[model samples]
Target: MFDYQIKDNCLSNKNILITGAGDGIGRQAALTYAKLGATVILLGKTVKKLEAVYDEIMALGAPEPAIIPLDLKGATKQNYVDMAATIAEQVGQLDGALLNASMLGELNPFTQIHEQIWQDVMQVNVTSQFLLAQALIPTMLNAKNASLVFTSSGVGNKGRAFWGAYSISKFATEGMMQVIADEYDSSTLRCNAINPGATETKMRASAYPAEDKSKLASPEDIMPLYVYLMSDDSIGETGKTLKAQ
Candidate 1:
């Protein structure tokens, strides 16, 4: 679908929420969507980073963006519910979401993974996403067309050594996306997952410290797929895993 160019203003009047919007792929997606004409709700743990993004958006003369400073690792179900309620009351219906926040727990043998680290990874990458989606479904339903994009990993599809809880969490993410897609098959809301293979981001550097970063695609480079998946151009595309490289 990304082979064709997305026209300017494709996202005009759209309201999208992006988790991890403070940096990396999430940050780029927020900027890209705003440039294309969407009101982006930035959700992330760091206020300073989110503020930077907000300032950048403002400087770009894009649509005014909103900030929701949240830590997925500690966010409760009620917190997600309240977030949805807040969006409904303050921002109206949500048109899309990029569920991009994730944790890279210590990569080790499954048996060697620390219990707390495993739990933290699952909480941030899987449980919080599920809860967020559950809470936001109503807001999405209000839109004529809604899109939900989950960030997946290559290790999630095919198990790799030493990926530990991160891999397992991504697998769960893929399953959650599929479940939501199936459940919403009759509705206008669509759900899909994207695997951003070997990107040049902090996470990638942490995972592969010795590798050359110059060869990897920057966060901005893979945004066409992100833009397409969130736009109306991807209508009827759901329950599929896309690679952004």
Candidate 2:
């Protein structure tokens, strides 16, 4: 895990948005950020799951959370633009956004990869992120200091034999992060990518069903890096692909 001693109310008065906030690492991150005094915007496909997370955050007596149920697979650039506008109108100014939602298509050999599966994976993991980032950038820039964190994978940098589109999308994600980071090199809004190495999540379970999940890290275990990137502690860091292990 990335080592950082998180101070109480580190994210006080901050308005952060987290995609895929209903489950796994996203869910844990929402709770964690809320506990640290951030007003989290929970965006996910499942309304029930988002509500559950909202309840959890409220139970923690943290800032009141807002939920936005969006299916990234079918969401358009216009949808993202409108959503960002809504966020700006309601939240006033955005401080951070975690582009953590992704899809894992069928794992197969290079020659056997399905076109639809490839398209679906790319749509959710790459295109949606691209659109969302484009829409959110202006709002994020409104803050005195902001962070835009993209989720990458272990196969993001290295091409894996059976990872297929998932790997490719992550590679694109890293590239996208680098591009945005470089563009805003001297700006208050910093961009970066995080590769959560082999954590125990549903995506991990589906990818390696036979593996021993007990040996893997939990979502909570890798949260230090997530928190660090969003916090003021990482003010100057940008364009790097960090690993949370």
Candidate 3:
């Protein structure tokens, strides 16, 4: 069921990093990139799940993927810097970075948004991305070209009564992408965000437990847009938000 006509080996010789890659869309994207011939770096909190993706990619004879266990909620700026340094030592230069890690927080009314919960959500869903991107851009700039894709939500563009922190975090995500994109407009680096509408993932299940999952598209269904954004094919295209249907 996982397939994209973007072709095999389109990312050959490139190195891409994806956060929250242990499961959900991040996991599928990592696998897709591996199959497309990119040396995929899987970053997440779960080592076991990362190993599962690593094995799956290796089984396909794709590049032996790398894994970094990181908890976005608690990770410090130094942690991100250290992570980038390690990637630089081993990978030389980065071809792409996908900031797919995010926390849904709680779906509640605006006035019911607790300060602690809001802070936690912003830390994982926004601050961490800022720090991670700040750390990794050097590796990307070192390459001939690079792409940075942040994951967004429908509620991010429009406020929802019960969406709370998750929605606010995504708005920041969009702003972050725009700022970064403008910073490197004259350079080889590009930044953008993707709103993968309703997808079959744990986050989706959590958000819509009453909804039928079989009715929604799988994360794998959006691989085309993912691959396109990461590949050189999308060169010169940056800063715009894309909706993956």
Candidate 4:
């Protein structure tokens, strides 16, 4: 349970960019990072949602957070490249980046997976993440020690039945993470993946409508691992999947 001290200023001079930060785990992570003294960049498709998150970070009197409204599902390489250039210009070098955005396509048998659903899920969950990481690599490498985390799932590590494109995308995500980690492990850039097991969030509710939510941990409860991974405490760590409480 939060092995680290979680110093009031753990992220004291860092800037962290989090995607899918409008809600769920991403939102919680943003708020936590802000409170811990990092300037947060909130990214999501919905401007209002990102605004709300920005307001929350501001209310805490933490750092002045920035909002980026862009849908990953339809984003292109140029879009990510432009975003990276802007971040480099504004924040200099990004100290941390969490690839928390994802799309849950039709969760059905592979044989029944819709063609559009497969493409859409891969766009957001895999392709977009790749492009974003590619764009931000330079910025991240510029940091003293930067951490890159990809949101992964249990089904990703092992192919499961009826999980369809979502699982496959996560698997790709994990592989992407390893590739980055292996290539940059000796450098300032470290890459890893997180499997926020059974967190209580809207996406989880949607995926498990019949299950009892009370049995799952809240997003807040899982921040310890997230915060740890984002900070210097885990500097030597890379190319592994972390499980959140």
Candidate 5:
């Protein structure tokens, strides 16, 4: 796992947004951030799951959380713009945003990759991120310091034979993070990417069903990096991809 000490109330008075917060690493991150005193905004495709996370955060006696039920696959630029506007109105400012929602599509040979699957992966992993980040930049700038974190994969920079569109989209994700980080080089807002290496999650299971689950790291094991990127500790770090293992 990433070497960082977890601090109490490290994110106090901060408003953090986490997409795909209903499950996997996203879910663990929401719970973890809430426990650390952040006012988390849980955004996911399932309303029930978001509500469940909301209740969990409230149970922790942390700040009350907000929920945004959104499916990235069908989301548009205007939708992201409106969502950012609403966040600005409701939270006043965004301290951090974890763009963790992504589609794996299917792992297939390049020549056998399906067009629709490719488009779907690109839409969820690339286009939605572009739109959301573009819309959220202004609101994020409201804070004294803000972090925009994108999720990348091991295949993100390397071209894997069977990774297909998923790998390609991750490459785009890395590019987008770099572009934003460069544009905001001297600004308060920082952008970065994280590759959660081989964690035990639903996505990992789907990709490798026969693998030994017990040998893999849990979502909680990889949260130190997530918290580090969101907290004030990573103020000057940007445009780099770090791994959590």
Candidate 6:
């Protein structure tokens, strides 16, 4: 399905929310969705970066995007509920959501990790995603069909030494996707996780500082799967973990 050709307006009239929309794959997904005719909600911690994406979308003559600055680490369940209410009031209903915001607390031995670091990683990666999905599921169900995509890593599906809390959090992510997918298997709401292996981004640079950057694919290069999942092409596909290389 990733290799399939997508129509120009495959996502027309859709309202999609993308967390971490300021940079990397999240940014590229927001831009691509907007260009394909979806009204994207750019959610990230940096207002300036979100504004830049909003400007670029307008400049490209795509649908004007909305900006929502949110820091997942400090966001509470009530905050997520409020955000969901706001989306319902303004956007009517959400056709899709890309839970792309995450943090790499540190890559160290599990036995040597600190409590605060583990908590921070879990809050941003696992807890925040849970709360966000819990709030958005109702709105998503309102649409004729909806897609929920979670960002995963190679280490997420398998244990890797020194990955520590980040790896553990990703495992939780995969589990969450599976549970949700199973619950909605008989419904029009589909959920899946995408593993973007070795993408060229700041996170990758931090994780592998000595590696050659040219060998890695850019975030924009792995967007075919992103577009495929968000559009109607992957309607019956759920609970699957896909890789983008």
> Over the stretch 1-245, how does candidate 5's per-residue lDDT look in tens digits?
89999899999999999999999999999999999989999999999999999898888899999989999999888899999999999889999999999899999999999999999999999999999999999999999999999999999999899998999999999999999999999999999999999999999999999999999999999999999999999999999999986
- Candidate 5: segments with Cα more than 4 A from true spot: none
Error of 5 at 91 (Å): 1.4
* Descending-lDDT candidate ranking: 2, 5, 6, 1, 3, 4
- Write the residue-wise lDDT of candidate 2 on 43-110 in tens digits: 99999999999999999999999999999999988899999999999987999999999999999998
Q: TM-scores, in order shown?
A: 0.98, 0.99, 0.97, 0.98, 0.99, 0.98
Candidate 1 lDDT over 55-124, as tens digits, reads 9999999999999999998889999999999999997899999999889989898899999999999999
lDDT of 4 by residue, 71-97 (tens): 998888999999999999998999999
Say which prediction, candidate 4 or candidate 5, comes out ahead on TM-score: 5
Pairs with steric clashes in candidate 1: none
Candidate 3, residues 30-69: lDDT per residue as tens digits?
9999998999999999999999999999999998999999
Q: Which window of ten consecutive residues has the lowest lDDT sum in model 2?
A: 1-10
How many steric overlaps does candidate 3 have? 0
lDDT for 139 in candidate 5 is 98
User: Which model, 1 or 2, shows the larger TM-score?
Assistant: 2
The superposed Cα distance between candidate 5 and the true structure at residue 236, in angstroms, equals 0.4
Comparing 1 and 6 by lDDT, which wins?
Answer: 6
Candidate 6, position 191, lDDT: 100
RMSD of 4: 1.0
In Å, residue 19's CA in model 2 sits off its true spot by 0.5
Runs in model 6 deviating more than 4 A are: none
